[model samples]
Target: MSAGRVAVAALFVVALVLFAAVEIASRREGSRVPSLGDVCGVVMRYRVGPLPVGRIAMFGFWWWLGWHFLAR
Candidate 1:
């Protein structure tokens, strides 16, 4: 496979593993993942003031930009 495809596949696997780890940690801690309300609250707060939404939007935006520029 080409380098770019390989990189994407590896990143995909890494993301899956990270997500699984988050889920496991959440279960062990007896704390649930962020709810829609939480995310909405974050967005609302962000609009009112600058706050780290945990880089969620930035990650998605950069991922989109990368795919737009790099993926054929």
Candidate 2:
């Protein structure tokens, strides 16, 4: 594999590890770390004027991801 691909894969692995660690920590008793759902809930609660900015932003993110990785 090329060095660039290797670097990107390593970064993706690190992100997954960090996410798993945080998720586990959030589940432990008396731990302060928030679960991913909690964070997303808080973010999605925000609004801009009449629009749900957080929700729109999330939709945009998912759309972008799908377009880039799933589209042929």
Candidate 3:
């Protein structure tokens, strides 16, 4: 796969692993962490592109930050 496809696959895997770990941990330990569905919903909403330049730039930054901080 190309770099972009690899990156996207990695992101999908990471999100699934994180969601599973957090969900199990929260249930077993009685913590207050958010559910996987809710978190994924929020993330999907934020991933949508925009109609304006500034909005697109901001969304680009948001996308950058997610990969920068979350991806290994």
lDDT for each residue of candidate 3 in 5-61, tens digit (9 for 90 to 100)? 999999999998987898887676567887766665565556335545545666787
Worst lDDT run of 10 residues, candidate 2, spans 42-51
Per-prediction TM-score: 0.43, 0.89, 0.42
What's the lDDT for all of these models? 0.70, 0.93, 0.74
Best-performing candidate as measured by TM-score: 2
Q: Candidate 1: where is the Cα deviation over 4 Å?
A: 29-72
Q: What are the clash counts of all predictions, listed in order?
A: 0, 0, 0
Ranking by TM-score: 2, 1, 3
Q: Give the TM-score of candidate 2.
A: 0.89
Model 2 lDDT on a 0 to 1 scale? 0.93
Residues 1-72 of candidate 1 have per-residue lDDT tens digits of 899999998998999898777666656555767644565567545542475654666567779989997997
Residue clash pairs of candidate 2: none
The local lDDT score (0 to 100) that residue 67 gets in candidate 3 is 100
Residue 51 miss distance in model 1 (angstroms): 25
